[model samples]
Target: MTSLFQFTGSELEAIKLSVGVAIYSSLISLPIALLLGYWLARKQFPGKAIIESLIHLPLVMPPVTTGYILLLVLGTRGFIGQWLYSTFGIKLAFTFEAAIIASVVVSFPLIVRSIRTAIEMVDPGLEDASRILGVGRLKTFFQITVPLAAPGIISGTILAFARSLGEFGATITFAGNIAGETQTLPLAVFAYMQVPGREIETLRLVVISVLISFVAMALSELYIRKMKRS
Candidate 1:
Protein backbone atom coordinates (compact mmCIF):
# COMPACT_ATOMS: atom_id res chain seq x y z
CA MET A 1 0.00 0.00 0.00
CA THR A 2 2.62 2.56 1.04
CA SER A 3 5.01 1.13 -1.54
CA LEU A 4 2.54 1.86 -4.28
CA PHE A 5 2.64 5.55 -3.48
CA GLN A 6 6.29 5.78 -2.46
CA PHE A 7 8.32 7.98 -4.76
CA THR A 8 11.87 7.21 -5.81
CA GLY A 9 14.59 9.70 -4.96
CA SER A 10 14.61 11.24 -8.41
CA GLU A 11 10.82 11.42 -8.52
CA LEU A 12 10.75 13.04 -5.12
CA GLU A 13 13.36 15.51 -6.21
CA ALA A 14 11.40 16.38 -9.31
CA ILE A 15 8.22 16.92 -7.35
CA LYS A 16 9.93 19.11 -4.78
CA LEU A 17 11.73 21.14 -7.41
CA SER A 18 8.55 21.61 -9.41
CA VAL A 19 6.59 22.78 -6.39
CA GLY A 20 9.39 25.05 -5.25
CA VAL A 21 9.84 26.64 -8.64
CA ALA A 22 6.13 27.09 -9.16
CA ILE A 23 5.65 28.68 -5.74
CA TYR A 24 8.51 31.09 -6.15
CA SER A 25 7.41 31.94 -9.66
CA SER A 26 3.85 32.66 -8.56
CA LEU A 27 4.90 34.66 -5.51
CA ILE A 28 7.47 36.69 -7.39
CA SER A 29 5.09 37.50 -10.24
CA LEU A 30 2.11 38.43 -8.07
CA PRO A 31 3.10 42.01 -7.27
CA ILE A 32 4.14 42.69 -10.84
CA ALA A 33 0.87 41.22 -12.10
CA LEU A 34 -1.11 43.32 -9.64
CA LEU A 35 0.54 46.53 -10.79
CA LEU A 36 0.14 45.72 -14.46
CA GLY A 37 -3.44 44.55 -14.00
CA TYR A 38 -4.39 47.74 -12.16
CA TRP A 39 -2.66 49.94 -14.70
CA LEU A 40 -4.28 48.22 -17.62
CA ALA A 41 -7.68 48.28 -16.00
CA ARG A 42 -7.78 51.76 -14.44
CA LYS A 43 -5.20 53.94 -16.09
CA GLN A 44 -4.97 55.38 -19.56
CA PHE A 45 -1.68 56.19 -21.15
CA PRO A 46 0.11 56.35 -24.49
CA GLY A 47 1.22 53.07 -26.10
CA LYS A 48 -1.06 51.10 -23.81
CA ALA A 49 -1.88 48.72 -26.62
CA ILE A 50 1.80 48.22 -27.31
CA ILE A 51 2.48 47.44 -23.68
CA GLU A 52 -0.39 44.97 -23.63
CA SER A 53 0.78 43.29 -26.81
CA LEU A 54 4.28 42.90 -25.41
CA ILE A 55 3.01 41.55 -22.11
CA HIS A 56 0.94 38.91 -23.93
CA LEU A 57 3.58 38.05 -26.51
CA PRO A 58 4.70 35.03 -24.47
CA LEU A 59 1.26 33.45 -24.88
CA VAL A 60 1.52 33.59 -28.68
CA MET A 61 5.26 32.94 -29.00
CA PRO A 62 6.76 29.48 -28.95
CA PRO A 63 7.90 28.50 -25.48
CA VAL A 64 11.27 27.55 -26.85
CA THR A 65 11.65 30.95 -28.45
CA THR A 66 10.95 32.65 -25.15
CA GLY A 67 13.49 30.40 -23.50
CA TYR A 68 16.08 31.19 -26.10
CA ILE A 69 15.57 34.89 -25.64
CA LEU A 70 15.96 34.53 -21.92
CA LEU A 71 19.13 32.56 -22.39
CA LEU A 72 20.56 35.27 -24.61
CA VAL A 73 19.71 38.04 -22.22
CA LEU A 74 20.17 36.33 -18.88
CA GLY A 75 22.69 33.60 -19.60
CA THR A 76 26.00 33.40 -17.75
CA ARG A 77 27.83 35.56 -20.21
CA GLY A 78 24.88 37.55 -21.45
CA PHE A 79 24.48 41.25 -20.78
CA ILE A 80 22.64 41.48 -17.47
CA GLY A 81 23.77 37.99 -16.57
CA GLN A 82 27.41 38.96 -17.02
CA TRP A 83 26.95 42.07 -14.98
CA LEU A 84 25.34 40.19 -12.14
CA TYR A 85 27.98 37.50 -12.17
CA SER A 86 30.76 40.06 -12.16
CA THR A 87 29.20 42.32 -9.58
CA PHE A 88 27.61 39.74 -7.30
CA GLY A 89 28.84 36.38 -8.62
CA ILE A 90 25.33 35.23 -9.26
CA LYS A 91 24.73 32.87 -12.15
CA LEU A 92 21.17 32.45 -13.45
CA ALA A 93 21.36 30.19 -16.48
CA PHE A 94 20.76 26.46 -16.08
CA THR A 95 19.71 27.00 -12.47
CA PHE A 96 16.52 26.72 -10.44
CA GLU A 97 16.29 30.51 -10.60
CA ALA A 98 16.12 30.25 -14.35
CA ALA A 99 13.26 27.79 -14.10
CA ILE A 100 11.38 30.21 -11.84
CA ILE A 101 12.01 33.00 -14.31
CA ALA A 102 10.75 30.87 -17.19
CA SER A 103 7.57 29.99 -15.36
CA VAL A 104 7.00 33.64 -14.49
CA VAL A 105 7.40 34.73 -18.11
CA VAL A 106 5.07 32.14 -19.61
CA SER A 107 2.40 32.42 -16.92
CA PHE A 108 2.53 36.21 -16.52
CA PRO A 109 0.05 37.02 -19.25
CA LEU A 110 -2.65 34.80 -17.83
CA ILE A 111 -2.16 36.27 -14.36
CA VAL A 112 -2.28 39.81 -15.67
CA ARG A 113 -5.35 39.17 -17.78
CA SER A 114 -7.30 37.58 -14.96
CA ILE A 115 -6.41 40.30 -12.50
CA ARG A 116 -7.10 43.07 -15.04
CA THR A 117 -10.57 41.70 -15.72
CA ALA A 118 -11.23 41.50 -12.00
CA ILE A 119 -10.07 45.05 -11.41
CA GLU A 120 -12.12 46.30 -14.31
CA MET A 121 -15.20 44.74 -12.77
CA VAL A 122 -14.67 46.71 -9.53
CA ASP A 123 -17.11 49.55 -8.98
CA PRO A 124 -15.71 52.97 -9.80
CA GLY A 125 -18.29 54.51 -7.49
CA LEU A 126 -16.73 52.83 -4.48
CA GLU A 127 -13.33 54.26 -5.27
CA ASP A 128 -14.85 57.69 -5.94
CA ALA A 129 -16.67 57.57 -2.63
CA SER A 130 -13.49 56.67 -0.83
CA ARG A 131 -11.70 59.56 -2.43
CA ILE A 132 -14.57 61.90 -1.60
CA LEU A 133 -14.24 60.82 2.02
CA GLY A 134 -10.56 61.96 1.93
CA VAL A 135 -9.05 58.55 1.42
CA GLY A 136 -5.90 58.60 -0.66
CA ARG A 137 -5.64 56.71 -3.89
CA LEU A 138 -3.23 54.16 -2.45
CA LYS A 139 -5.37 53.59 0.60
CA THR A 140 -8.51 53.12 -1.45
CA PHE A 141 -6.67 50.73 -3.71
CA PHE A 142 -5.38 48.57 -0.87
CA GLN A 143 -8.56 48.72 1.19
CA ILE A 144 -11.47 48.71 -1.19
CA THR A 145 -10.15 47.78 -4.63
CA VAL A 146 -7.97 44.90 -3.52
CA PRO A 147 -10.60 43.34 -1.25
CA LEU A 148 -13.21 43.47 -3.98
CA ALA A 149 -10.87 41.89 -6.51
CA ALA A 150 -9.38 39.28 -4.20
CA PRO A 151 -11.23 36.47 -5.90
CA GLY A 152 -9.78 37.21 -9.30
CA ILE A 153 -6.27 37.64 -7.90
CA ILE A 154 -6.51 34.30 -6.14
CA SER A 155 -7.81 32.59 -9.28
CA GLY A 156 -5.03 34.04 -11.39
CA THR A 157 -2.42 32.98 -8.82
CA ILE A 158 -3.67 29.41 -8.83
CA LEU A 159 -3.74 29.31 -12.60
CA ALA A 160 -0.21 30.63 -12.74
CA PHE A 161 0.93 28.05 -10.20
CA ALA A 162 -0.62 25.26 -12.27
CA ARG A 163 0.99 26.58 -15.41
CA SER A 164 4.36 26.78 -13.68
CA LEU A 165 4.08 23.20 -12.49
CA GLY A 166 3.47 22.02 -16.04
CA GLU A 167 6.15 24.13 -17.66
CA PHE A 168 8.49 22.13 -19.90
CA GLY A 169 9.96 23.65 -23.04
CA ALA A 170 11.04 26.92 -21.48
CA THR A 171 12.37 25.31 -18.32
CA ILE A 172 14.28 22.66 -20.21
CA THR A 173 15.71 25.17 -22.62
CA PHE A 174 16.78 27.78 -20.09
CA ALA A 175 17.44 25.60 -17.07
CA GLY A 176 18.90 22.46 -18.79
CA ASN A 177 16.80 19.86 -16.93
CA ILE A 178 19.53 18.93 -14.47
CA ALA A 179 18.35 16.27 -12.04
CA GLY A 180 17.93 17.28 -8.37
CA GLU A 181 18.40 20.88 -9.39
CA THR A 182 16.53 22.36 -12.33
CA GLN A 183 14.68 19.18 -13.42
CA THR A 184 10.99 19.68 -12.60
CA LEU A 185 8.13 17.20 -12.88
CA PRO A 186 7.39 17.86 -16.54
CA LEU A 187 11.04 17.46 -17.42
CA ALA A 188 11.18 14.28 -15.39
CA VAL A 189 8.21 12.92 -17.28
CA PHE A 190 9.86 13.78 -20.56
CA ALA A 191 13.05 12.09 -19.43
CA TYR A 192 11.18 8.95 -18.43
CA MET A 193 9.37 8.85 -21.75
CA GLN A 194 12.62 8.82 -23.70
CA VAL A 195 13.85 5.69 -21.97
CA PRO A 196 12.49 2.17 -22.35
CA GLY A 197 10.85 0.35 -19.39
CA ARG A 198 10.10 3.71 -17.79
CA GLU A 199 6.49 3.90 -18.88
CA ILE A 200 5.21 3.36 -15.35
CA GLU A 201 7.23 6.23 -14.00
CA THR A 202 6.12 8.47 -16.85
CA LEU A 203 2.50 7.55 -16.27
CA ARG A 204 2.81 8.28 -12.59
CA LEU A 205 4.14 11.76 -13.29
CA VAL A 206 1.41 12.31 -15.83
CA VAL A 207 -1.23 11.44 -13.26
CA ILE A 208 0.32 13.77 -10.73
CA SER A 209 0.45 16.58 -13.26
CA VAL A 210 -3.15 16.07 -14.26
CA LEU A 211 -4.28 16.02 -10.65
CA ILE A 212 -2.51 19.25 -9.81
CA SER A 213 -3.94 21.01 -12.84
CA PHE A 214 -7.41 19.69 -12.10
CA VAL A 215 -7.29 20.95 -8.53
CA ALA A 216 -6.12 24.36 -9.61
CA MET A 217 -8.92 24.61 -12.16
CA ALA A 218 -11.49 23.48 -9.61
CA LEU A 219 -10.31 26.12 -7.17
CA SER A 220 -10.44 28.79 -9.85
CA GLU A 221 -14.00 27.79 -10.72
CA LEU A 222 -14.99 27.94 -7.08
CA TYR A 223 -13.51 31.41 -6.78
CA ILE A 224 -15.41 32.58 -9.84
CA ARG A 225 -18.66 31.25 -8.41
CA LYS A 226 -17.96 32.93 -5.08
CA MET A 227 -17.24 36.19 -6.86
CA LYS A 228 -20.53 35.93 -8.72
CA ARG A 229 -22.39 35.28 -5.48
CA SER A 230 -20.88 38.33 -3.83
Candidate 2:
Protein backbone atom coordinates (compact mmCIF):
# COMPACT_ATOMS: atom_id res chain seq x y z
CA MET A 1 0.00 0.00 0.00
CA THR A 2 3.04 2.31 -0.18
CA SER A 3 1.88 3.36 -3.60
CA LEU A 4 -1.47 4.35 -2.16
CA PHE A 5 0.23 6.45 0.48
CA GLN A 6 2.25 8.55 -1.94
CA PHE A 7 1.66 12.30 -1.97
CA THR A 8 2.25 14.46 -5.02
CA GLY A 9 4.24 17.70 -4.89
CA SER A 10 1.08 19.79 -5.11
CA GLU A 11 -0.56 17.73 -2.42
CA LEU A 12 2.44 18.15 -0.15
CA GLU A 13 2.40 21.87 -0.80
CA ALA A 14 -1.23 22.01 0.20
CA ILE A 15 -0.49 20.15 3.42
CA LYS A 16 2.38 22.48 4.25
CA LEU A 17 0.32 25.57 3.55
CA SER A 18 -2.57 24.26 5.60
CA VAL A 19 -0.31 23.57 8.59
CA GLY A 20 1.33 27.00 8.39
CA VAL A 21 -2.05 28.70 8.17
CA ALA A 22 -3.36 26.69 11.10
CA ILE A 23 -0.41 27.70 13.27
CA TYR A 24 -0.64 31.34 12.30
CA SER A 25 -4.37 31.52 12.87
CA SER A 26 -4.11 29.81 16.28
CA LEU A 27 -1.41 32.20 17.45
CA ILE A 28 -3.41 35.17 16.25
CA SER A 29 -6.57 33.99 17.98
CA LEU A 30 -5.07 33.07 21.39
CA PRO A 31 -4.52 36.51 22.93
CA ILE A 32 -7.86 37.77 21.65
CA ALA A 33 -9.55 34.68 22.98
CA LEU A 34 -7.93 35.13 26.40
CA LEU A 35 -9.09 38.71 26.77
CA LEU A 36 -12.60 38.03 25.56
CA GLY A 37 -12.80 34.87 27.63
CA TYR A 38 -11.69 36.66 30.79
CA TRP A 39 -14.13 39.49 30.27
CA LEU A 40 -17.02 37.18 29.46
CA ALA A 41 -16.24 35.12 32.53
CA ARG A 42 -15.70 37.94 35.06
CA LYS A 43 -17.63 40.93 33.82
CA GLN A 44 -21.31 41.68 33.35
CA PHE A 45 -22.78 44.72 31.65
CA PRO A 46 -25.67 45.90 29.55
CA GLY A 47 -25.32 44.71 25.95
CA LYS A 48 -22.90 41.95 27.03
CA ALA A 49 -25.14 39.38 25.44
CA ILE A 50 -25.24 41.35 22.24
CA ILE A 51 -21.46 41.67 22.22
CA GLU A 52 -21.12 37.93 22.73
CA SER A 53 -23.59 37.16 19.99
CA LEU A 54 -21.56 39.30 17.63
CA ILE A 55 -18.36 37.55 18.59
CA HIS A 56 -19.89 34.15 18.05
CA LEU A 57 -21.70 35.19 14.88
CA PRO A 58 -19.44 33.22 12.59
CA LEU A 59 -20.16 30.03 14.49
CA VAL A 60 -23.84 30.20 13.66
CA MET A 61 -23.72 31.97 10.30
CA PRO A 62 -22.97 30.23 7.05
CA PRO A 63 -19.26 29.99 6.19
CA VAL A 64 -19.92 31.35 2.71
CA THR A 65 -21.65 34.35 4.23
CA THR A 66 -18.70 34.93 6.50
CA GLY A 67 -16.33 34.73 3.54
CA TYR A 68 -18.47 37.12 1.55
CA ILE A 69 -18.46 39.57 4.43
CA LEU A 70 -14.71 39.31 4.73
CA LEU A 71 -14.39 39.82 1.00
CA LEU A 72 -16.56 42.93 1.10
CA VAL A 73 -14.55 44.36 3.99
CA LEU A 74 -11.12 43.38 2.70
CA GLY A 75 -11.48 42.87 -1.03
CA THR A 76 -9.54 45.08 -3.43
CA ARG A 77 -12.45 47.40 -4.08
CA GLY A 78 -13.79 47.36 -0.52
CA PHE A 79 -13.72 50.62 1.42
CA ILE A 80 -11.17 49.41 3.94
CA GLY A 81 -9.39 47.48 1.26
CA GLN A 82 -9.43 50.59 -0.87
CA TRP A 83 -7.92 52.63 1.93
CA LEU A 84 -5.30 49.96 2.56
CA TYR A 85 -4.36 49.82 -1.07
CA SER A 86 -4.29 53.59 -1.46
CA THR A 87 -2.15 53.96 1.65
CA PHE A 88 -0.01 50.84 1.58
CA GLY A 89 -0.90 49.21 -1.77
CA ILE A 90 -1.97 46.03 -0.01
CA LYS A 91 -4.58 43.65 -1.38
CA LEU A 92 -6.24 40.96 0.72
CA ALA A 93 -8.86 39.25 -1.42
CA PHE A 94 -7.84 35.92 -2.96
CA THR A 95 -4.38 35.78 -1.45
CA PHE A 96 -2.45 33.70 1.06
CA GLU A 97 -3.06 36.35 3.68
CA ALA A 98 -6.76 36.18 3.01
CA ALA A 99 -6.65 32.46 3.74
CA ILE A 100 -5.19 33.20 7.14
CA ILE A 101 -7.78 35.87 7.84
CA ALA A 102 -10.60 33.58 6.82
CA SER A 103 -9.29 30.86 9.10
CA VAL A 104 -8.93 33.28 12.01
CA VAL A 105 -12.46 34.60 11.60
CA VAL A 106 -14.08 31.18 11.33
CA SER A 107 -12.10 29.61 14.19
CA PHE A 108 -12.37 32.54 16.61
CA PRO A 109 -15.62 31.59 18.31
CA LEU A 110 -14.57 28.06 19.19
CA ILE A 111 -11.43 29.44 20.80
CA VAL A 112 -13.44 31.98 22.78
CA ARG A 113 -15.94 29.41 23.97
CA SER A 114 -13.23 27.05 25.15
CA ILE A 115 -11.31 29.81 26.91
CA ARG A 116 -14.42 31.37 28.45
CA THR A 117 -15.51 28.11 29.95
CA ALA A 118 -12.03 27.54 31.33
CA ILE A 119 -11.81 30.99 32.89
CA GLU A 120 -15.28 30.74 34.35
CA MET A 121 -14.32 27.51 36.05
CA VAL A 122 -11.45 29.30 37.81
CA ASP A 123 -12.44 30.58 41.23
CA PRO A 124 -13.05 34.31 41.58
CA GLY A 125 -11.84 33.99 45.16
CA LEU A 126 -8.35 33.32 43.86
CA GLU A 127 -8.22 36.58 41.89
CA ASP A 128 -9.70 38.50 44.80
CA ALA A 129 -7.16 37.03 47.16
CA SER A 130 -4.34 38.05 44.86
CA ARG A 131 -5.63 41.60 44.68
CA ILE A 132 -6.02 41.74 48.46
CA LEU A 133 -2.35 40.81 48.73
CA GLY A 134 -1.56 43.86 46.58
CA VAL A 135 -0.64 42.00 43.45
CA GLY A 136 -1.15 44.08 40.34
CA ARG A 137 -3.87 42.90 37.99
CA LEU A 138 -1.44 42.19 35.17
CA LYS A 139 0.90 40.23 37.42
CA THR A 140 -1.96 38.33 39.02
CA PHE A 141 -3.43 37.45 35.66
CA PHE A 142 -0.18 36.17 34.17
CA GLN A 143 0.93 34.33 37.28
CA ILE A 144 -2.32 33.04 38.71
CA THR A 145 -5.26 33.31 36.33
CA VAL A 146 -3.28 32.11 33.32
CA PRO A 147 -1.77 29.09 35.02
CA LEU A 148 -5.19 27.97 36.12
CA ALA A 149 -6.60 28.59 32.67
CA ALA A 150 -3.71 26.98 30.82
CA PRO A 151 -5.49 23.75 29.98
CA GLY A 152 -8.41 25.51 28.41
CA ILE A 153 -6.17 27.90 26.53
CA ILE A 154 -4.16 25.00 25.22
CA SER A 155 -7.32 23.13 24.33
CA GLY A 156 -8.77 26.15 22.63
CA THR A 157 -5.61 26.81 20.68
CA ILE A 158 -5.51 23.26 19.41
CA LEU A 159 -9.15 23.37 18.42
CA ALA A 160 -8.63 26.67 16.62
CA PHE A 161 -5.72 25.25 14.67
CA ALA A 162 -7.76 22.17 13.87
CA ARG A 163 -10.65 24.25 12.65
CA SER A 164 -8.28 26.17 10.43
CA LEU A 165 -6.90 22.96 9.05
CA GLY A 166 -10.30 21.69 7.96
CA GLU A 167 -11.60 25.07 6.82
CA PHE A 168 -13.07 24.89 3.32
CA GLY A 169 -16.03 27.10 2.47
CA ALA A 170 -14.63 30.32 3.94
CA THR A 171 -11.11 29.85 2.66
CA ILE A 172 -12.18 28.90 -0.83
CA THR A 173 -14.75 31.66 -1.07
CA PHE A 174 -12.48 34.40 0.26
CA ALA A 175 -9.02 33.29 -0.81
CA GLY A 176 -9.82 31.39 -3.99
CA ASN A 177 -8.05 28.14 -4.89
CA ILE A 178 -4.67 29.29 -6.08
CA ALA A 179 -2.38 26.31 -5.81
CA GLY A 180 0.65 26.77 -3.51
CA GLU A 181 -0.70 30.19 -2.58
CA THR A 182 -4.18 29.75 -1.16
CA GLN A 183 -4.96 26.09 -1.81
CA THR A 184 -5.14 24.09 1.41
CA LEU A 185 -5.53 20.38 1.94
CA PRO A 186 -9.30 20.51 1.80
CA LEU A 187 -9.15 22.66 -1.29
CA ALA A 188 -6.68 20.24 -2.81
CA VAL A 189 -9.14 17.42 -2.14
CA PHE A 190 -11.91 19.45 -3.71
CA ALA A 191 -9.78 20.17 -6.74
CA TYR A 192 -8.71 16.60 -7.18
CA MET A 193 -12.28 15.38 -6.86
CA GLN A 194 -13.14 17.17 -10.11
CA VAL A 195 -10.59 15.22 -12.15
CA PRO A 196 -11.23 11.73 -13.56
CA GLY A 197 -8.97 8.92 -12.25
CA ARG A 198 -7.72 11.20 -9.48
CA GLU A 199 -9.65 9.26 -6.85
CA ILE A 200 -6.46 8.09 -5.21
CA GLU A 201 -5.18 11.64 -4.95
CA THR A 202 -8.44 12.81 -3.50
CA LEU A 203 -8.57 9.97 -1.00
CA ARG A 204 -4.99 10.60 0.07
CA LEU A 205 -5.66 14.22 0.94
CA VAL A 206 -8.94 13.33 2.62
CA VAL A 207 -7.09 10.83 4.78
CA ILE A 208 -4.44 13.37 5.69
CA SER A 209 -7.04 15.94 6.57
CA VAL A 210 -8.92 13.47 8.73
CA LEU A 211 -5.76 12.38 10.53
CA ILE A 212 -4.72 15.94 11.31
CA SER A 213 -8.18 16.87 12.57
CA PHE A 214 -8.39 13.70 14.63
CA VAL A 215 -5.09 14.39 16.35
CA ALA A 216 -6.09 17.93 17.19
CA MET A 217 -9.49 16.87 18.56
CA ALA A 218 -7.88 14.11 20.58
CA LEU A 219 -5.44 16.56 22.14
CA SER A 220 -8.21 19.03 22.87
CA GLU A 221 -10.30 16.31 24.49
CA LEU A 222 -7.37 15.23 26.62
CA TYR A 223 -6.89 18.76 27.94
CA ILE A 224 -10.61 19.13 28.54
CA ARG A 225 -10.58 16.00 30.66
CA LYS A 226 -7.56 17.30 32.53
CA MET A 227 -9.20 20.68 33.08
CA LYS A 228 -12.33 19.03 34.51
CA ARG A 229 -10.37 16.77 36.83
CA SER A 230 -8.42 19.65 38.33
**Cα lDDT of model 2 by residue, 114-202, tens digit:** 99998998898999999999999999999999999888899889989998998999999999999999999989999999999999999
- Put down candidate 1 lDDT per residue, 108-186, tens digits, no spaces: 9989999999999999899999999999999999999999999989999998999999998889989998999999999
Local distance difference test, per candidate? Answer: 0.92, 0.93
Estimate the Cα RMSD of every predicted model relative to the unseen true structure: 1.5, 1.4
TM-scores of the candidates are: 0.95, 0.96
Q: Supply every candidate's count of residue pairs whose N, Cα or C atoms clash at under 3 angstroms.
A: 0, 0
Q: Give the Å shift of residue 79 in candidate 2.
A: 1.1
Q: Which pairs clash in model 1?
A: none
Worst 10 contiguous positions by lDDT, candidate 2: 219-228
Candidate 2 matches the true fold with a TM-score of 0.96
lDDT score of residue 214 within candidate 1: 92
